[model samples]
Target: MDFFSRQESARRATARMLVYMVVTVLLLFAAVNLVLYGCLWLVGHHALSRSVWWWHQWTPQAILGTFLLVAGGSLLEWFRLRDGGRTVAEMMGAIPVDYATRDLAERQLLNITEEMAIASGLPVPSVHVMKQESGINAFVAGLIPEKTVLVVTRGALDHLNRDELQGVVAHEFSHILNGDTRLNMRLLAALSGILAIGQLGGFLMRSLTGGYDGRQTRNPVTIVWIFGLALWLVGWLGLLQGRLIKAAVSREREILADASGLQFTRNPEGLAGALWKIREQGSWLSGLHAEEISHLCFGESLNMQRWLATHPPIDERIEALYPGYLARMRQRQKNPRPAAPTAPTPPSWNPEGTLGFASTTGRFAAPDKPLFASPSPDEPIPFDGVFSSGGLVGRIGELRMEDLESATWLHRQLPVEVTRALQTGTGAKAVLYALIARFQPMEPARLRALLADRASFASWVEQVGGQMQSLDARFALPVVELCLPRLALSDAGEVTGLLAELNVLAMDNDHLSVFEFALLKRVEQHLRPKPPLMQRHALESRLQPVAVLLHSLLAFSSHDEAAIARHHHQLMSELCPSPPAIPDHGLPPLEALDKALHQLRSLNPDGKRRLLDLCARAVESDGILHIREYELLRVIAGLLDCPVPLLQGVIHE
Candidate 1:
């Protein structure tokens, strides 16, 4: 399935999750009422079957209370999870890998994760190791890609080689890109209420049993006992339902993830070898919460009934990756063939030909070539401000090996000092400041002013300023991506200062450029509280905001107003029965456009794809995506919770 299909599947799983919770709530309500009626009868009020007074008076209260209890419990658990992936990582007994970790295995793990992240247009997620678990397994968790964490058992590090480890890490990245982590988070929250109910029942049984005295209504001991029994039963059933849902929705995804990860590495053995190791060594975890998060693992975390298993059996998964793979492996063991070489970046790799996009996708050949060739950073990135009337159009969804190699290669071109700087929290903050200073040099006075007041930031900017001056424009985004993990390590006040300074530097200019807005937005995505999970919003209702955004993109990049209007006409013609009036007042300012982008965040996943298609066709008519347009489009896609790695393979400095 494509991105839209993945989104629809997530929505379907969410619907099932809600349904399960509703049924559990209703069952609990009935159980509570039944216990009440039985107690009243035992206390000599009225016959249980004939009781109308209590039922009429308390039924509404009982349902209301049950709903509140479930909601309150869910809210509490959500607050606990506010830190996103970090919170979940801690629960799994994972210790974060230091950015400057000395161990070779941990360092390799960090490098592989970083390459895959940049290659896929993802934030470099924090890496953690489950030191206590010896299982050959790993999984990703978070509310969004920025806050996402990658957790691997110590066994994975010990048993897997570089390629095997990369295969496993790529599989986890697939979850972040596919929107599975958010789904897992939602499911975790939904199940919390049932878990709380079960725990409460267990606690009550233990606490009140001694007061029973063998009397039916002895100080309400009998009533508490019945209520606890019913709750325990409901909790048991809720747990059963959770497992069934996990099996139904989660099992099929394992195959897709395996295929997607292999596509990235293009080494079937790399992934298959990982699976072979798992089959022989097993992926079962000894963590206390293993059973609860089995659905989120790279392999099944528990040895359970076949029907309730969270992942497909290891043999079946290996077979999917390479049919009749056991014999191939046995033969290989006898012959002992060498591990495969990493794939090279194809000379012809471009947005048009790679990732299933039409051969004439956007541009004729090398993307970002001009920017890379510029002798110095003083020359600003180029923008033709011209679009094809016919629009660049084609089907696109998958990643190619060139994407990973090219992204990694481009990142490696960065000066070694800059990369080293990114390994520390203070240095990462300085890198952000240095990027702003270099790219928006016109606003250096304001930047200096903002940093001068904050002593720590001031020193950081001074330290990195020299090396970053020669940094290629193409590496700006990559460096920003690398800075995230380190920034994540910064203290709260320091990060807040960094963000505030960014705003101070950017806002001094009356109207921000699309580039500046995107630059700020990218950093803020990780530094700020994560955006809420995607919720469905109809295109019809969101047209105005979408138009506001489209207008900014069309007007800013195009010198011809007529071309802008024509493209807007095409977008509206496709969207509405009768087109709405275009803004005669000209493109909305950046602040208004920023608001418009935020408002459109609620667009359904399918709607997001459609809107993006409309937007791209409107501006990308030349079959080539220039750097300016790519910057604009990439940021917009990021806000929509979509991946825009199309330009990742473009050769750059």
Candidate 2:
């Protein structure tokens, strides 16, 4: 499905859940009323006549009270989990994976995650390992891409080979891209509310029976006893309904994820093999809260009733991956045969007309030629003005085997020092400082004075500045992206301090260069603990703000006044047909541009697409797409939650 379809699916799932919740609440209301009527009737049996009507015992207040109780409980649980993916990860006892770890397996996991993030054009999610569990399971959790976290079991790392591990990781990434996490979290919250009803019943049963006090209450009518029993039974029924809902939603998504994983690796056997391993070994978790998140796991956490299994059965999943395997297995069972022993082959890197691939060894081989080469100025630019907003959204989390291969190639091509620096907080901070210094060099006297008080930080920056300057422009953003996870390890205060220092250094010359602004903005976007709330605005109402952004972008694209005016006119005609008076003032300051972009972000998805189309027009108006301009466009597209893979491909080509 495309991105738009996935989003629609999520909305539909939410609607379906609401229907289920309403039905559940109604059932609980009836059940509670029945129990209350029975209790009241028995309680008044000795004082009232036998002919007293049963309907007289029923009270609207009782039903209303029960409905309110269930609704309030569910809302409380949902609100508690609003913090999103991290809360779910903690519930599963997942610990963050250390970037500086020396463990080869963990290092491999980090490397694979990095490649996947780059290929998919997303910020790298935090990786967590469920060290306590020895189950071959993994999952992705988060309300959105930026807050997403990937969790895997220790057993998976221990048992799965590199190819199998990559398959599993890719499967989880599919959930992230497909917008499944938000739906999954919603299901979790809804189920939590239902379970609370059951728990309340259990508590009532225990209290009424005097199970906690070791003595029963002497209520001869047995009214309270029947009421407690009814509550307990109804509560379990709610639990059953929740499991069924989870099973229905999770089962279908698992199949889709399996297929998407194959698309990511271009190796069906990789995922099929992981499933086979899970079957042979076990995917059962020994944790206390395992069943609470059974639906979120890579495989079923409990050997639940077939109708309530969160994931489809292993044989069925494997069959979906490799059709006719089950028939072949049955035939083999009918006629037993000895397995043949084959010689093991060493993994070799192969690259033909297709993208490069390493054999099962999982080692990435450097390509014979650069995977991407810069297009010469005379090359025919691949500019297609027809923009499909849905198509672009679909590509947001989409990845092909070729993209993965390219990611591997890019990772290998990065400078060794750059790679090392990304593994530690101190080094990462220095790298950011050096990147800023490259754009805004300070005078010797000022530089000496700035260094006087901060000896170590200044020395590190000076040492890395020259190296960072010599690096290719294409690698600059990716290097900074790679450093983010480690930099994120610092406390919030430390990040604030770093941002302050960067601002000071960038403003040393009293102006923010385009590069400086883009770099700082991108860094701040990721480093902040939470993103600003996304507000929606109508397209017609946002015309002037859109024009301001386009004008600034056009001005930044070229120094030639004619080219700038030409692009501005084109944007105005296309985006603002009525043609507002063009502001004759020079380019807006960085702060104004930042505010304009932030406001533009409030536009709905379709509105954002139009804005991006205008951006594409502005960049290409000069007939030369400079690398800096291309990078700037990419940063903007990413912020807008639109992936411009086609435009990105043109630049890489």
Candidate 3:
């Protein structure tokens, strides 16, 4: 399935699971109420008869009370997990991986994660290691990409080779990209609700039996005793249902993730080998909350019955990846051979700095230089290019294998200091400061005045600003994205201070460039604690506002006023048959544009898709994609939750 389909499927599964959970809760409610009524009949009326009239035992108050109790408990549990994936990680006692660690295994993990982040065009997720866990397992957790966390067990790091580790990390990335993380959170919430009743029951039973004290109860036939017994029975049943629900929801997802992982790495042997190691060794976790997040794990963390297993059997999973795995194992046993050592290969670079395909000769080679010619400003834009709104949606979380390889090459090509700076909080601040200072031409006196009191910060910016400015502008946004996960490690106060400094620098000249707008917008979106909620808006009612937003976008795309006007007319005509007049004012200021985009976010998916199509037209109207325009488009698409893939024939020059 495509990205949208996978997302839709996850939504459907969540809905179906919710329905099942509600039914289970109702059943439990009835069971609890019936038990209460029975106890009342026996204790209050002195009747032990099983065939007593059912109507006499039934009470509206009892039914309502039980229903409220169950529903309330479930909601409470759901609220407890509102912090999402980070909460789950903490529950497992996972520690954040230090990016500066010199450990080879840790460095390899960070490198693989960086490459994947670049390839997927998503922010690098926070990485954590389960120090006490000896399981060959890993998992990604987060309701959304910005807050996501990827966790690996120490055993996974120790047992898996680089390729095998890539396969494992890729599997977890599939979860993050496929919208499975949100679904997993829902599952965790629902199960906790169901188990809450059992926990209450256990507490009540313990109180009645004097289990909490050093004495035993004298009377076992009291109403409290009978109710406690009923609750105990109900609680255990809930536990059973919780496991069954997890098994039903998670097993199929595991298979799909395995397939996606293979698609990402194009290395079935690596994944298949990991599975082999799991079968021969083990993937079991000894953590406290292992059972709670078993379904979120890459491999089954608990040994469960077949019907209750969160993952398919290890053997079955291996066989699915390699159809004749059992036969291969027998052959290997009979004629074991040492694996050959492979030589490392360098990345291929083209003379024009464009990426080119390298031959599979285990050695890098330079490509022949091609004649370079710049397109004229008057060149006609290709209106007939293959552009699919649906195809764009499908590319949201999907990455080609070639992109991954390119990302790997790109990571190696980056300056070592720049890479190091992105890995820590202080360095991340320096990078951002340098990027902002060099984003546009700023008067030296004005900049110095703006930083008059902050000597240390100003010095750092001056030190790095030259290097940052000399680098290609196209890489600025990507580098900033790489720094976000680490920057997130800063305390709330530190982030607030950094954001304040950023805003000051952005507004120093009283005008925000397209690059500055895009940079600040993307950074704020990640750092801000509360994200804007998506709401539905009527396209017909909001057409003028959207047009004004599009006008601003077009104005930034080209310097030619006539060209901008033509592009605006073209897009308006396409969106509305009877085109509305362009706003009387010139290009809206950055603040106005920000407000317009915020309002446009409430447009329904179809409306957003149409807006993006108009955006593509505007960007292409100039017959060339400028770096600033490209960055703006990306920021807009990201805000709409409709990511566009890198366009063809668009160089970042």
Candidate 4:
């Protein structure tokens, strides 16, 4: 299937999730109404016949009971969120990511991720290695686009070579792209709510049992028996509801995900090989927490009971892929096709071919030698610009008028030297601008400088851009970012490393200013996503005001204080509805921010900490937590990760 077909499939998956949610909501509503009506009938049947007071007198009590049921359900959802992280952590910890007292299997995990990202047109996800298990298993978790985590068992990494690992990553990426992750998370939340009903019934039963005494058991004990019987029935009903949801929907989701994974990779052998290895090494995941994630595993994580199995039998799955393989196994038949005797057919295009010849063709004319030596100026940047207007062509119409209009705006008058300058801080702005501009042309002077700096062609873009009239800066930036993630890391150690690099770079030019440092922080923020709780509009709004302040500090203070305030306020309001009112000090524009920053910097050792704290407070100005706000807070926190908050000791310069 093409990209659009797969996207349509994902849409169908989303529709399925919505349908499940609606059904769940309807069932819960009906069940609660039935329970309420039954309770009201028991209490009001005699009262209605007497008519001593209004039969409507019992309405308030009935309403309260219904409210309690709904509140109980809401509480369950809250409880799951509170408990989810710990539960997942404890399960993961059971199978440690350490082999022979090592810190983490970082290299193998990273290699797999890099290969997978290369294969799939997606961002490389965060990688986690679980070392205790020798079983080949993997799983992915996260709700949003940014926070997805891809976890692999140590056995899979150590046992499977690079190709097999690539296969596994491809499978996980398929789950992410196909919209299964979101559906699975929703199911978890809904199931948690349904299960809470059983817990409530159990709680009531325990309380009643504890309150009963010896004398109460004898006289009119039938009421107590009936009450106990009702509680038992209700608890069982709740349990059954939870199980039915899991069995009916949750189990089938795995099969769909597996099929989707196969469709994405377009190579059944990748998965089949991994599965075959699992069987060879004994497919038992040796971890205490295996049961928690059993349903999400590539293979069975736990010993399956025939009735409660989430996944179909592995043999059946293999048979589905390799038809008649099971029959061959049963009959002990020999393979019809001989292995390794014939060479595989090659693709039509060969990379080694000359310019005029096709990629796969071996024949090349001698006249095309000069063309190969000095290729034409307009060469396509392959596997680049996959996210921009050029990449979106397949999804929408190819080269539409609106797309051209937008691409024209992206056209920059960048110098070719800007590519080389991107390696250092000197030409970062020009390169960044050029990158955002799709149709940018290089100036003559910039091209000459790039030709002179041929020795510093650190990456493919620099080398190619040096000779070309125009280059795909959009593609090059992401490639550089992916290849050099330390350029992206905002951890304390990483910050220190960057500071050292800056120190060396500024040896001849003297000290780096606060403005430069702030710019670097901004760039880093753009590269990484913030934590869920901190991602908010308030934080993004805070960026515009802060950006303006930084520009002013860099000797560009043309706008008045009122203008600045209006811009800041406008940004904040855009980010959050009903933004917190800003108090007017009637001072110069950005004076408050300048003062706070100066005070923060003068603290020397604690300067970074103060800045982070200030940023956190600024991000929460709207009094509501958002994901963007969380991300901004995290970026600032990373800039100051070194210093811990002190107790009695005041931080003075």
Query: Which candidate number would show the highest TM-score if scored against the true structure?
Result: 3
lDDT of 4 by residue, 248-285 (tens): 55456566555655554455655655666665565567
Which of candidates 1 and 3 reaches a greater lDDT? 3
Give the Å shift of residue 181 in candidate 1.
1.6
List residue ranges in candidate 1 displaced over 4 A: 23-72, 211-234, 330-397, 442-450, 453-463, 490-493, 507-513, 533-536, 576-589, 622-624, 646-653
The C-alpha RMSD of each candidate to the native structure, in angstroms, is 7.3, 5.0, 5.0, 16.4
lDDT of 1: 0.71
Relative to the true structure, candidate 1 reaches a TM of 0.81
Write one digit per residue (lDDT tens) for candidate 2, span 1-653.
Answer: 75546656766777877888888777777767766666666676553344333343455765766666676776886787776677778888899888766666676787788888887777788899999988799888877666778899988888887788888989988887676887887788778777766677777667765222236655543455566677788888888888878887888788888888888788776788788778878888888878778888888787897888988889988888888766666686699899522111222222221222333554456767766666775685544532233333445456877778777777766555555566688888878777777656665356546667888767766777756666656666666777777777678799898889888878888888777787787778778734435477766677776777777777776788787776677668865567664565455456666777777777765676567767766766665566667667767877776544323444522
The C-alpha local distance difference test score for the whole of candidate 3 amounts to: 0.73
TM-score of each model, paired residue for residue: 0.81, 0.86, 0.87, 0.49
Cα lDDT listed for each candidate: 0.71, 0.71, 0.73, 0.43
Candidate 1 residues 266-325, lDDT tens each?
Answer: 877778888998887889999889977899999889998999898888888888887878
- Which pairs clash in model 3? none
Q: In model 1, what lDDT does residue 420 have?
A: 66
Best by lDDT: 3
Name the regions of candidate 2 deviating beyond 4 angstroms: 45-61, 206-229, 324-363, 374-394, 439-451, 529-535, 572-576, 583-589, 643-649
Q: Higher TM-score: candidate 1 or 3? A: 3
The true-versus-predicted C-alpha distance at residue 545 of model 3, in Å, is: 3.4
User: In model 4, which runs have C-alpha deviations exceeding 4 angstroms?
Assistant: 1-8, 21-91, 94-106, 132-135, 158-162, 205-208, 211-214, 217-240, 243-256, 263-267, 276-295, 300-309, 324-653
